[model samples]
Target: MMRSSPFLRGTALAVSLVLSAPAMAGGYAKSPPAQQSNEESRHRTLTNSPSYVPIAALTATVQANHRARGLLQIEAGLEVPDAQLRRRVERYMPRLRNAWVTALSVYAGVNYRYGDIPDADRIAEVLQEATDMTLGEEGAQILIGMIIIHGD
Candidate 1:
């Protein structure tokens, strides 16, 4: 039963670090951390495909009993079969999003209720019309992901 000297403990720690360094270096030398992350992210982005464009957080004011209660958040995506149309969709996303926000707001104001489920078919219809109207053609298809109503 004895205490190790400062020199002994320091030497032991240094030796352990020196022994572990090669293994750690080899592990990372295979692929740098940042590059690995970028590769993984690129793989995911590819798997999702350029055809599917995500539309996130389309919210509308939910008014109940003559007062604002909460908000109705709609999440959706567009599936365009044509790569050219997909590029156009991305280019016109700002205008398309504006049109959708207006349409969705109106739909939420008219159709949605405090304790009722949002009609998926009707919402999709609304979004499709908005898309077609904004894009001035028929190509991209609206795919609804979530219709969540946050209540107060």
Candidate 2:
């Protein structure tokens, strides 16, 4: 049996960690979670708590010219800090999903392209508008997760 050197084992471990680390730009990564500051940890906890309401992945077909091109998908959720507001958001999850679908359809049709990077700000604004319209207030903070386009 061949025993690996300590340096090789350490290097291997580090390479695996680096590969597993999440990319901080343009995509969501879940590495260094423990390194997050206290406030960040609290915020993360809050989002995963009862106050954080999860939304199923919102998807729409990317359309251009006169046919379907690809699928645009985004994962998101609502963070309602107030307990009462959280209850309301939970109750309205279905309505919120519907609104998000409608808004995403519009955005995909007008703003997104099949091969280009997605415009996250515009998408967030669209989702936020839908949220405001459906909830009739601005208590729920929209927490957008991953935004990606699947090419046909």
Candidate 3:
């Protein structure tokens, strides 16, 4: 029988240790790369993207009219008698729809002229306010329904 040299035995052991250590851990380990900055992402998003100006402008206008309608509903509810209020509300339905549509149209035209969409945050704010005004309010339900029916 031949005896193995001590140096060869030690070298074999070292190689086995290195390979076995990784296998024991189950796989290679590494941290993911850090996220890109917001500014960098925004710049990428805006670059070469087609303008949505008309849609944005229309969204703003519709939102504004939505708010106006809510206010008018509340005011009418408080001021007018129930029977008369219903009639008045019915009468104003056409006007309210027209107002919303007109707002959207004007904004769309402006956006077209400018060749860039306006930010929708302002319009969104107004619409949110209008939505808040309608919730839990008595006469607002009918008015909101009317606005939806006429506007749609």
The clash count of every prediction, one per candidate, is 0, 0, 1
Question: After superposition on all CA atoms, what RMSD does each candidate show versus the true structure?
Answer: 7.7, 12.7, 19.0
lDDT of 1 by residue, 51-138 (tens): 8887756888888788888888887888999999999999999999999999988987888876788888998999999999999999
The whole-model C-alpha lDDT of candidate 3 against the native structure comes to: 0.36
Global lDDT of each model? Answer: 0.85, 0.83, 0.36
Candidate 2 achieves a global lDDT of 0.83
Give the clashing pairs for model 2: none
Number of the top-ranking candidate, with TM-score as the measure: 1
**Native-referenced Cα lDDT, model 1:** 0.85
In angstroms, the error of model 3 at 49 is 41
TM-score of model 3 (CA atoms): 0.23
Error of 3 at 62 (Å): 13
The sequence of per-residue lDDT tens digits that candidate 3 reaches over residues 55-94 is 1111222223333211111111112235554455455555
What is the lDDT for 146 in model 2?
Answer: 83
